[model samples]
Target chain A: MNNSKQGMTLIVKTVTRVTVWLIVLYGIYLILHGHLTPGGGFGGGVILALAFLNIMLAYGREATQKWLNLKFLEDIEAVSATLFLFMGLLGIALGGRFLINFLPKGSPHALLSAGNIPILNILIGVKVAMSLFLVVWVLAGLHEEKGGQS
Target chain B: MILPYYIAIPLLSAFLISLIAGKKDEWAVLLSTTAGASMLILSIYSLIAQNGETFVYKMGFWSLPIGIVLVQDGLTCLMLVLVSLISFTSLIYSVQYIRHMDRNWKYYALFMLLITGMNGVIITGDLFNLFVFMEIALFSAFALVAYGGHAEEYEAAFKYAVMGALSSALVLIGIAILYSATSTLTLAKIAEKVPTLDPGLIFWTGGLFLAGLGLKAAIMPFHAWLPDAHSSAPAPISSMLSGVLIKVLGIYTIIRLYFNVFNAPDFYMQVFLVLGAVSIILGGLLSIVQWDMKRLLAYSSISQVGYILVGLGIGTRLGILGAVFHLFSHAIFKSLLFYNAGAVEMALGTRDMRKMGSLARVLPITSATSLVGTLAISGIPPFNGFISKLIIIIALIKAGAPVYAILAVIGSILTLGAMMKMQRYGFRGETEIKKISEKIGWRMNTAMILLAVLCLLTGLMLLPGIRESIVDPVVKVLVDHSQYMQLVLGR
Candidate 1:
């Protein structure tokens, strides 16, 4: 019954709008508890990106661009990657070896037991989420660009 | 310590540039060049400070069976130095050269990743680690090839990616087979255990490597993608591809595995000889017919690499020395020539040699540098190419391979002819001056001049004192195959 020129029908949009927050929450859970479970940064990151992809498909690109610009996403990607690199460098400063695990390992099965691994997982998750978003969005929009390529 | 930085610095720069740099690309240029400069210094420092001593750095304090290791020996040092030097020049050249490409910071970012991959491949002592690093290098290379956003460029990049993916799969299979058979992923450990494996398994593993790495290296039969991919990239990138990338990804791994790990088996040596001779002659002949300036340079790279393979296939001390020296010299001269090609293309907006002429009047520096490059590639006297080629031919005669020596001379002649054709048509022609789309910038000129000077001076690497200190150590690594195992594994 939906007759919109852009974006999907009412049912698809409604389902996506309601489910987006839950998908993202699940992704955050995956990243935060990465050290304790099977799902880590990459697995969680793909799930997080899928949330955005769903939004893009349901609400159209122009609508998504209004709330989230590609440039901001890129900045997020860069910052997360830099932070990850900084963690590795900090390893050298603290332990005299590159990427050496200098942080204290807490008791087994605890949420924060694996020292810097959870921190790294969170960083990688954010970076991967941003990259997938950018790549997919750009490819989708590739056909619309005029001859500005030099 | 320095070995880690070789991988770390470039990866950090790539991330930082994307994070911090603005739309303008000035910071991108500054940061990349600084990174390149530091790497060059660090590589030189390691080479001199170690003075041929082997240094192995264990990752995260893990032992050989469990963790990755970075090993730096004479061969690694030579490659590290060569890579850093060419990359520094290419970065300088790209500062002004890539200005017209709209989003230039991304170019720098990808380029840094390419460097990181190459440095990783050079320093790593683990087998699977090498494959990982090779992928990093190849991925960036594919992106850079299609950077122009042209239809043909995309076509070329697609072809390269397909070939590269197939090669990677084959390499993975080879690594898997070796791992299953030997139960070790450390290269030195594999070398120690390989002699005891079933001969049939060894044959399959070696053949898989020969085919897989051979495709990456673009030997005689597997050379379809080199010309298109090399010619289609941005000029500085083309220089990087033809100059160091092929050697790093293809030739270096081949020699490292075949000689150091496989102990230069007789059958594989025969394959090297036949492929080397065929690529040399056929590549030279193909290059002579190319009307596109960069395309001809691409074909020429195949020929030059063929010479290196021939030297390696000869399987003697003098022959291996010739191979390493030629690899060194070829990196300098070929890059210089590609820079000249890039500069010419930048000015004219065309790569067709038929459309170029009288550039000597407008682009004096490019002309002068290109002449040096042409001479060096053609094996003329006083240039590094001549000495290296002479050594190879002499080694061939000494090794009692007179027929291959004859073919080598013919290949050299064909190279000379192709290079002269390039100079005559592209620089010295009487075609009236055409519209100049871009002016040759100072940075580009500086890069060309730097490489051109090195083309004449690198032959000094063979002098008595220098040879004792520099060249001998590298040759020693290849001559004594067990040295890699003993030095890296301490067995």
Candidate 2:
């Protein structure tokens, strides 16, 4: 019941501590298996972001800031988006159309089989995860600032 | 293949500018200006290279109907040129205009993203792709409208976002219906299959599309957000919104879907006529009562857009040609007017027409250029608006719609009255506030001057040689709806 610390109650934190990593791992699995599964870049990316949001909700702003700074998250978002665009352009530079699958298609079901799908998934996952974190960070900051001022 | 760069360059520059801008204003401006310039050049080159031919580039090496494709037809080329030109001018104008504002980088980034979205919408050969691009444009526009972060701006942006989202939902439902009925997301394939489907289903889908795109276009009853959104945003963004966004996101999509995809049913043509006439009458009447400079311009945009719609609704070859010409001319003069209004606000620190006086003596360049814009917009002789309006009226009568032609003429008279009111009160009257700064920045002046010149010369596009080279192909594409499917499918 002690609200002195910057987070929720002990039970929620304890539960989040166990579940967050599992959710993150599952997201990565979904992204890796995107070509063979129903989940792709966007679906897995949202899940990954949810994992971070769980940590933020359970441990609060200061702890999240320690783990990932807002400025660093913004940079990651921008860089990842730029990387996705660059990869698309790289397709054209390699004598194919933009966003074409230029790499070798190994096997259908394997993790690395889908040419460029996993790479794109990873890039989108990072971008989406960082973007959601930044949004939460800003909202939290605004709330704290208002609470302090009033 | 070359078509992808139209989208790629802006997307790349947008993210790169965000990454590198980091409070450095110069990088954002330079990168965005360069991107806009490159897009303009690329569009011109593509226009020349295609030379009335259609070029389709398939993404991921997938064949037509299976993969995403970018089709550069005459209509697409015309839209690309207009988008790039207006965006380029706005970026240049923003260099000076937005210098006083915070977060200049985000502005440039959003601006580039908007251009990317418009280019994607213009070139994409897929239905869902158009929807995706519309979202990109809408999101950026919503943000840009609220960029000032004032109370009124927030209110305007919230209203715009709600209306925009509702419209987008309608469009999605329509797309879903079309896809369910035809089992295809490719526009060309849908066009080929749409005629064979149940007329009732097609009518429902068409109605949904009209309501959705109509909201975005701000046609008559759906025009609640334009006055606030156009007037509250920063000046450069207002120009972009009025000059290109509605035309591209709203009118262009409506035309593409109705004419090409749906084969221009007579029922929809009648709908276009009614909506066009109502919007023209209401918008012009509303403008006469406004004292705010940008608000007047905003209402005027609605009226002018109605003219374009009327032309399109007439469904004659001359009518289509007039519509296309008026569209191009409107892009030039409306942006010019918005820029001039921005300059006036910059100098006088007020948008109220009653407070502005003797600006012609102090801000000579802006005043002069704005006069040209006013005359052009009023359909005065020798300017671009006159020729386009004449064509539309003549075409209307030729199509045996004398009533609509008369209504159009009435709209023109009201437009002239409103513009004369703006010119007289805002620039010609005796000096009201003597302490206000009279000087406008050089970049702002240059942009307005450039647009004014274009406004004067764009009428030349109606000439036989120029008409054949540019406007005729656009007319051809719209008139022969089957040509769209044939060109995209290479049949």
Which has the greatest lDDT? 1
Considering the two chains of model 2, state its CAPRI-style docking category. medium
lDDT (tens digit, per residue) of candidate 2 on B1-491: 58999998999999889888876789998899999999999888877666788888989788975788889888998899899999999998998778756556888999988888888899999999999999999999998999877778988888999999999999999999999999999999999998799999889999999989998988888899999999998999999999999999999999899999999999999989889999888999999889999999999999999999999999899999998889899989999999999888988888999988887667889889989999999999999999999999999999999999999999999999999999999988777545556467777888998999999888998788877778888999999988999888888
lDDT per residue (tens digit) for residues B415-447 in model 1: 999999999999999886756888888899999
TM-score of each candidate's B chain against the true B chain: 0.99, 0.98
- DockQ (Cα-based) per candidate? 0.58, 0.59
Judge candidate 1 at residue B462 and give its lDDT.
96
TM-score for all models, in order of appearance? 0.97, 0.97
Q: What's the TM-score of chain A alone for every prediction?
A: 0.92, 0.87
The digit string of per-residue lDDT tens for model 2 on A23-99 reads: 99998888777888998778788898899888888888677767777676777899999999889989988848888
